[model samples]
Target: MRATTIHAPFDMRVEEVPEPVVQFPTDAVVRVLRSCICGSDLWAYRGEAARQPGQRIGHEFLGVVEETGSDVTTVQRGDLVVAPFMWSDGVCDYCRDGLTTSCEHGGFWGTVGSDGGQGEAVRVPFADGTLVQLPREAASDDRLLSALLTLSDVLGTGHHAALGAGVRPGATVAVVGDGAVGLCAVLAAKRLGAERIIALGRHQVRTDIARRFGATDVVAARGDEAVAAVRELTRGQGAHAVVEAVGTEQSMRTAIGVTRDGGAVGFVGVPHGSGTGVDLGVMFDRNIALRGGVAPVRSYIPELLPDVLDGTIDPSPVFDMTVDLNGVPDGYKAMDERVALKVLVTNG
Candidate 1:
């Protein structure tokens, strides 16, 4: 079998590696059919996030059950499924409370000695709690499969951001960043009935997707200029809610600046570079609330799945580029160079 490995910055290879097997009674082996590179993967590719040489990398995947351990009963051979970025034991208190990411036994893929989602197959721990079944027929529908793939991460994550930001019917919402997650945040806000959505981004291609996803306004500026544009658009009142989808200190500040005095900000950007340390003084004086961290996507998937199946939301557009296992190195290059919005990795 062949899987993606990182040897250094901008170097990913699809080389022969050991195939996974059912290692625990709660485990299952999935024959991967679809997987994609996440924006966060770039942290490793850019050398910003420390990763051991030859560490397996990738976190979102959809596949069919090839085998399952004795304790795994919710799925069987031939069933199509999607795995969240993290695997968690379903019976934990946090899992019951919709915080699966914090489950007592939860763990992320691509860690030391773990198989990643970007390969021919994966060893899924806590299969029942981490894998969500999708219709078997979807395997043949390329576009639908692509849309369903987002359920494994981005769509659920975007929904998490909107929920944290307190999006409600008729509320004015602003999203910072125009990457795939940010654009999906705009879509989530629309699904929640936000009347006005302001998307901040400088990329025409991504901002264009933001419009299609439900952004009513696009601010193509940064710093004070971007803040002023959003404020002016809201008549100096700012947005009722702001979502920080970029995990930069400046982006967080902009999210706060674009929010109404009494509003809230939901941030989902992976924090790097001391990006999201909020100012207590500003939050206290403005009566603003801040909430958001790594999204527990497994908790949100059940609610968002039906919508994707029913065509209520089509997030497939976020995947502007597609590559096979052999092209993964180029895929990382495309994303790093901003030549692709998001790269979808497909297998048969």
Candidate 2:
């Protein structure tokens, strides 16, 4: 088997690697069909996240089940599945509370305790709890791939942001970032009945997708200018709901500052330590609500999968760059340079 490995910043390689095999009673082996690159993956690729040499990359995948552990009766061989980015034990306390992302036994994929989806095949732990079995009818459906794949992360996280932000019918919502997750937030806000969806992106392609998904306004400004634009659009009152999809101090501040007093802000960005210095006093004075962290993808997959299967949403456009497993380096570069919104890597 061959997989994408990051040796250092700007030094990524696709190399031959050992195939994964089921190692635990609760494990399942999946032959990855479509795996895509994530923005978070760039942290390691740039040496900002300190990834070990030869570490497998990617956390989002939709694939076929090749094998399952002895105790895995919920899913069987040949079934198409979507594995949540966060592996969890379904019965854990936090999982029961719909916070599977923080499950007592939760483990993130593609890192120290796990392997990512950037290879021919990968082993998923807690198969029954972590892998969501798609209906057979949806297995061969071409349109389901993008939306189904999103259940592993972006879509679910977007939904979490929307829900946490308390997006409502006729509400004005602003989203920071035009990445897959941000576009999905726009889509989520639309689904939640938000009347005005404001998306911030300088790229025409991304802005177009955000519009197609549901954004009613697009702000091409960055930093303070973007925040000011959001406020102006809302009659200087700011948006009723704001979602921070980019994990940066600028984006986070924009999200908070552009939201109306007493409104809510949902942040799903993989905070790289920049979220710690927020002005809690301002948040308190304005009566603003701040919520959101790692997306509890496992808990939301079931609800969102049906919408994907039925064509209620189309997230596939996010995959603007599709390449073979061997093109991993380009995939990483395309995203880091903002040349691609999302890169889809195929194993076959």
Candidate 3:
């Protein structure tokens, strides 16, 4: 099978790799039908996140179950399923509490001996806990496939941001960042009943999608200007809640600054650069709450799957470009150059 491997920064290639097989009783071998590059995947591609030479990369994917281990009963052969970015055992205490990302036995794909999602197939551990089964008929629908694919990561992470920020009916919520995750956060806020969704993004392409996703206001400003814009929209007060989707110091500061005192900020960006650290004094003085991490996507998949299948929320617009497995390097470049919001890779 051919898979994506990162030899170094800006160097991605497709190489022939051995196919995966069920290695654990709780594992299942999925024939990847669709996969995509994630914004976070850029961290390693840019050398921000250390990467081993020839390391397998990618994590968002949905597929058909080709085989299941003896202990895997929840999914069977031919069932179309989606695997969360992280794999977790369903019975762990953290998983039971809806924090599966912190499960005792949870692990990410493309690490050590695990298979990455950007390939023909992958061996998914904790299959019963990590894989969400979709209607068998969904395989033939392009719209549903795109939406289901987002459930594996970006969409769920966006939903996590909204949930963490404590978005409520009639509340004014500001989303910081205009990436795919940021746009999805806007959608999640709308679904949660936020009356006003303020999106802070400079790119017109993404801001346009944010509007379609339910952003009531698009503030193309940054720093002080961005904060002021949000404040102006909120009638001199900041938003009641803020979702910080870009994990940068400036973005985090913007999120904190634009949030009303006593409000919360849900930060989901993978912290990078000077924005990696935060000033506790600032948060303390404002009485602001911060919550978010690697989203417990598995926990949210069940809740969001129905909406995706029923066409209640269409997130496919985030995928602005499509490519075959071999065109992944160009996909990365498109995103890096800001030419594409997200890239969808189909197994062809």
Return model 3's CA RMSD, one decimal: 1.0
Question: How many clashing pairs in candidate 2?
Answer: 0
- Could you tell me the lDDT of residue 69 within candidate 1? 94
- Model 1 scores a C-alpha lDDT of 0.92
Where does candidate 3 stray beyond 4 Å? 274-277
Instruction: Give a tens-digit lDDT track for model 3, residues 42-64.
Output: 99889988888888888999999
How far in Å is the alpha carbon of 178 misplaced in model 3? Answer: 0.4
- Residue-level lDDT tens digits of model 1 in 185-248: 9999999999999999999999999999999999999878999999999999899889999999
lDDT of 2 by residue, 216-330 (tens): 9999998789888988899998998999898887788888888899999998987876355367887899888889988898898888877877788877787888888889888
Alpha-carbon TM-score of each model against the true structure: 0.99, 0.96, 0.98
Q: Count the backbone clashes (under 3 Å) in each candidate.
A: 0, 0, 1
Which pairs, if any, clash in model 2? none
Q: Against the hidden true structure, what lDDT does model 3 obtain? A: 0.92
